[model samples]
Target: MNRSSECITKDSSRLITTELKPPDISLVQEKSWNAAVQMFGSFLLAGFGMVAASLVLDVVQHWPVYEQVSEVYILVPALLGLKGNLEMTLASRLSTHAHLGHLENCLSTITLGNLCLVQCQAILVGFLAAMAAVAMGWIPSGEFDIHHAMLLCASSVLTASVASFVLGVIMIGVIVISKKLNINPDNIATPIAASLGDLTTLALLSWIATLLYRSIGTNILLPAIIIIIGAVLVPVCGYAAWKNKFTKQALDEGWVPVVSAMVISSAGGLILDFTVSNYKGIAVFQLVINGIGGNMAAVHASRLSTTLHTGQLEGPVISATTKLLLLMVVPGQLVFIYTIGYLKAGHTSLTPIFMLIYLSAALLQVFLLLIISHYMVVWMWKLGIDPDNSAIPYLTALGDLLGTALLGVAFHILYAIGDKDSDLGD
Candidate 1:
């Protein structure tokens, strides 16, 4: 939106390489009927792996103690899932922006400034959300303390921000990599992101929680805050780098800033994590809140994109509706939320109730996703912007957040009406 960003946008076309990579039929490979079969097979295998993990966790541990301990610790998984989702969502959305030429100036000052502001806002919101979750009976009640929760939340903010910073680089890299592979990064970012979120978040969260809880026992508030401050400064350096004249040409030229952002983010995260030994309990709960913020940013940003070029009021509204239906209404991540609740509570029976409630809530959620996507589609058409890959990830992520709320409400309502002596019941 600023002068520097505009310059990047004008010169964006120059970033395209005259030499594109030849299509490979392996990993970056396109799909055929055979590939579809293989994909489905892999998905089946992955589901079994999930079941096996749950079983192992269920068998070896004293389930109730684990649940109680997890009430404090469980935040890590959900938060990890959330940040994972958020990072992926934003990355995917940005990838689409690049595909659409909206991110022509990936190295522009304005872009860096915008991301820096958004990252801070995300951390703040994540912290508050962690507090709210603790208050709402989401955290382990007596097993964890305010100090533990505080440390966890603080660390989560630091860790997630660092992850997000790296994600920006990965996202930008995705575009370049896509061009090199003769594939569309727009298509690759979303699904790959969600999958990666599910996978790596567990390991990262476990390492942080184990280390932090072992040493300072959650009293390292000072260290936690200090690390967070330093982590925030990492982005400041990013903003400065984008403004430097030497690197200004690199935006339209190649992959320097993207790599730099990633390296800085990863290294900063490792340094901040040195205090992981001081963490008391359940440190990752903060990621969930951040994840939600990520979802909100992605969904709204995508919706915003669809509306930018539309000349009429209805354009965004319509486009939003279609995206909602296509993504959230179909294969939205309902299973993950219920799993979080069930796994943390160690109330496997409650999972069925959660299911009933979640499914019912999904119906309404689908409607919401549909309406918003519809609004966005029409809006984009009116605005004259090409609206496609971007909106789906945004809408899906948003639907996850909204669906969580809706499912919560549904459970509350169902509980309220249970055992009523009406014709609808026994």
Candidate 2:
């Protein structure tokens, strides 16, 4: 038995050696270091930017439609933050090189084409969702006319889409840098991209709002119409891109992501709008879909593609999977927090912000508990452990806390801000 066990150990060690890819020491030293700095800086800026935008928007919401409102400052972060969770979807995939296969190339045409299509599709989906909110009255009709609302919606789509597109390009570039430096894009891309998207999207959203209010006569009627137009056109544009020769293959290759993202985004808006119209308050109702779907695992497949310089096939899978999983975990958990806060203080906003504040006092609460699980999988991989061996399921179950903690922290922060404002008033 001892001799048999020794033989088995020898075989296992050999298998591990055969599967491992050698590290690129020089690449890690040069390119990776730079990328890390930029990525970290970007994350901090985004976080601060979001806080600023939220405050600005809160102020804008108080103004009268067509009342010469000048709170355009909020536009900055609102644009970036609007699609906070989504921008990472494509950025990570393209950088990771998941396109050709689980193990593939990065600079390939297939990868680029797919990035274009997915980005466009995501934009359309976002538009549809935003519009559906307006259509169903989930997003309160501004104290203005339908035309102004339409304008806001239209501008929102263009701003969000354009910003998302630019960010995708930058994210891919950074991931490529990570790959060139022999670092795994997966490790760096998601967090950085997520933060950037949040910052840039929110900022842009606020800018669009300001611009629309100025040139469109501030009637508020146009924002809704604009949103409807955007919701209609964004997907059509994506479909058109699909028919383009370069992306035709990508379109075929990534049909499911394009279709599904559009559907879900649109559906979510409609559903949330329904809830809002019926309930009648400033509830963080978007969770009915987005929060639930956030935790799905694309797990750097597409990012791996870009890092490996591979194909489009990997990105959408990761995007779709991550979105699905996150939806299930985030919404349900945050809703609980929102309910708790409302019951206690009788005010509401996005639930995630409230939960985040729970962190300030209770370090090991539900939200904080998730951090261990979220990071463990990440930590295990750093130790060269493959999740396929045993940890995947446990890690995923544990990941439920990532969203919970994030939402908790978010909820807590927002609630605290509101409280501060109340105190000032009192």
Candidate 3:
């Protein structure tokens, strides 16, 4: 009877031990899977929305005014990148605040300060992007004069200022909505902000350019005044960003990422300038590919930044979060490539070779970005720097460069393959 009691006691102890063991591993895997789904879904939806916006670029390409000024194409990518950089950075900053439990229901001091900084950065960066485009255009075309440069600069500043305000409000609203829904703002905010930025900036650029073109001849004074106002406002805003304690951090933390993104984006603009003639047929596709890649990178960066801040991810090692994000990339890339091919083929004949090339380039770009984002986020966090301030802008800008380069290579490969097939058939 004592032996039987001992056996039963031992069995009970084993059962209690089993029950007491934490389900941490399984629980973590489940959470990571859910986070990955939410992020991938949000970015996929945003990417599709960007595709619809890119169709408008197709229309703009055919416009008489756009055709008249060939330099406008050189400015397009840079301007869009600037707008996206500003908004994505804002989203990242806001997401970090939300993760840290610093965000309030109303417009906090930090929120107001960030809004001011974004406006200032938008106007300042718009002016610089215009100048850069003019310089880049001069290298290839030698057709742009001060009149053209001023027009581009004025238009960029005006359009960016307006769009910044509108999109800023929308981004804040997204964060608020995400919080109310018990969703992670980091997952949704950057992608949505980036897509909206692309659409609004492109539409505003077209409208503003047309209006500026029509008015330049009749009211020369207006353009000069606008330029002067932009010149004055930049310094004033800079001073405010520098002087105010609340806004100074933004200026300090944002300049490197923002500037780096602009430089990289300018390279993308140069690519567009050189290849616009050759790839005119695939203009919309090119824009969509770059925009989607950049948006995806921004999403990943934002989430990684938040995770690092919240201590959910301690290092850059391939944690469950990293695994989930990488896995999410596969389905997202497949959906985007297939959907784009189906929709775009309706307008232009897309051969199997071309589709294969597009898919290859997109996959390569996303994979590269994932690796870069992991290392960069980890490195920044290790150095005690805020990844939120740096990661999104750097990743998005690098995405533009990689996306453009990969697309060019894909085109060449397709051509080479086609030539070989023709030769064999002959």
RMSD of each: 12.0, 13.0, 11.2
| Inter-residue clash pairs, candidate 3 | none
What would the per-residue lDDT of candidate 1 be over residues 1-426, giving only the tens digit for each residue?
344334333332221221122212232233444333322333333333333434443443444333433433445434544454355435544544454344444435434643553354345434543554465454344454655565456555655565556655665666557656655443345444444444444444444544555556545666366456856764575455455432333222222222232333334234324322322111221122223223333334443442332222434343432343333322333444444445552222234554565455655665565566556545544443333323443454455455545544553465465612221111
Alpha-carbon shift of residue 64 in model 1 (angstroms): 12
TM-scores vs. true structure, each candidate: 0.49, 0.48, 0.81
Q: Candidate 3, residues 103-177: lDDT per residue as tens digits?
A: 542245556666677778989888887887788778887565777777888888888888988998888788877
In candidate 3, residue 30 scores what lDDT?
Answer: 41
Best by TM-score: 3
The reply for model 1, stretches above 4 Å from the true place, is 1-71, 77-85, 100-122, 133-146, 217-222, 225-368, 376-398, 401-426
Better of 1 and 3 by lDDT: 3
Clashes of each: 46, 99, 0
In candidate 1, residue 345 scores what lDDT?
29
Worst 10 residues of 1 by lDDT: 14-23
Worst 10 residues of 2 by lDDT: 7-16
lDDT for model 3: 0.71
